[model samples]
Target: MNVVEVKGTELEDAFQIRREVFVEEQGVPLQDEFDGYDESGAAARHILVYYEDQPAATGRLRWLGDTAKLERICVRAAMRKFGLGSVVVKSLEKIAQEEGFCKAKIHAQTQAQNFYERLGYRQTSEEFMEDGISHIVMERTI
Candidate 1:
């Protein structure tokens, strides 16, 4: 698998991956999934992973002040359990740090808390519901 930084036309693939996982699979209302952040977020960085020349996973980083929030992380269902998700996160974290972010945070789904923990992210709050799904805030200092 290979990870690549994407922008402009290349970002369509990453957006589609998020739409498939968050909107279509998880039912996270389409309107809420795609928002105003796309056009003006100078800190936004998208990372896409490909396997055998096919897009297999994707994620994005949105910087807020000194912190970079990693969001919409997802691997194509058929590509799960293959470490593609980890690759996507690690690559994003590297990019975040290189960009001078002091920390990285993510709102991890409750079911995936352990996964994030294994990746060095620690839960910073009790579980909460967002758009009907349980989630918790996790963070890792860069």
Candidate 2:
């Protein structure tokens, strides 16, 4: 498996992975699944993970002041057991730290809270609704 920074037309692969996991599988609205931040020239840095040359996971990094916001993290269901999710998060964290950010945050789905916790993120907020799903804010210093 390998992670690559993708932009322009290359972003299509990332979007496909997100659509499969977040839209088709999770029921997120098409409009909500995509946003202006995905467009070219946006400040966000998108990452794609490929296993055997096939896209397996994707996420993006955006800055919120001094904090790195990790968003759209999703792994292909079949690839979940391969730890691609962790690879995506670690890659984003590494990118954020290299860019001078000391903190990173994610709005983690309630069901996946434990996964993030295992990675050293601690919950900082009560459960809340985001895009019609239960989620909570998690933070970690990278």
Candidate 3:
């Protein structure tokens, strides 16, 4: 497994994984699944994870004041069994730390609350609807 910072043509690999997992599988609207944060000049870093040279997962990290917001994290259905989701989160956390961020946050889908908890994140807000799915804010020190 390998994770790399990507942009330009290589960034398309990350978008493809997101479309497969978020837009196609999760029913998230195409318009909501993407936004200005994905642009090349946006204040965000995107990462693509590869398993045996195939893109398996992707995530985005955006700095918001003192916190690093981890977003759009998803793994291809076929790659879910390999624990790539944790890898994606940890990689993003590492990047945040490297960038001088001391805190990290995620708006986690309720279905994955336990997953984030297992990685040391604690729920910081009540469940709320986001993109029509129940989600809660989670935070942890990076």
Best by TM-score: 2
Cα lDDT of model 3 by residue, 82-130, tens digit: 9999999999999999999999999999999999999999999999999
Query: Least accurate stretch of 10 residues (summed lDDT) in model 2?
Result: 76-85
Candidate that beats the other on lDDT, 2 or 3, i.e. the better one: 2
Range of the 10 consecutive residues with the lowest summed lDDT in candidate 1: 34-43
* lDDT of each residue in 1-142, candidate 1, tens digit only: 7889887788888888888898999999988887665543455778899998999899888977778999889999989979998898899899988887879999999999999999999999999999889999999987
lDDT string, candidate 2, 24-142, tens digits: 99999999999999999999999999999899999999999999999999999999999999999999999999999999999999999999999999999999998899999999999
What candidate 1 gets wrong by more than 4 Å, as runs, is: 40-42
Clashing pairs in 1: none
Using all chains and alpha carbons, the TM-scores for the candidates as numbered come to 0.93, 0.99, 0.98
Tell me the whole-model lDDT of each prediction, alpha carbons only: 0.87, 0.96, 0.95
What TM-score should be assigned to candidate 1?
Answer: 0.93
Q: By how many angstroms RMSD does model 3 differ from the true structure?
A: 0.6
Q: What are the clash counts of all predictions, listed in order? A: 0, 0, 0
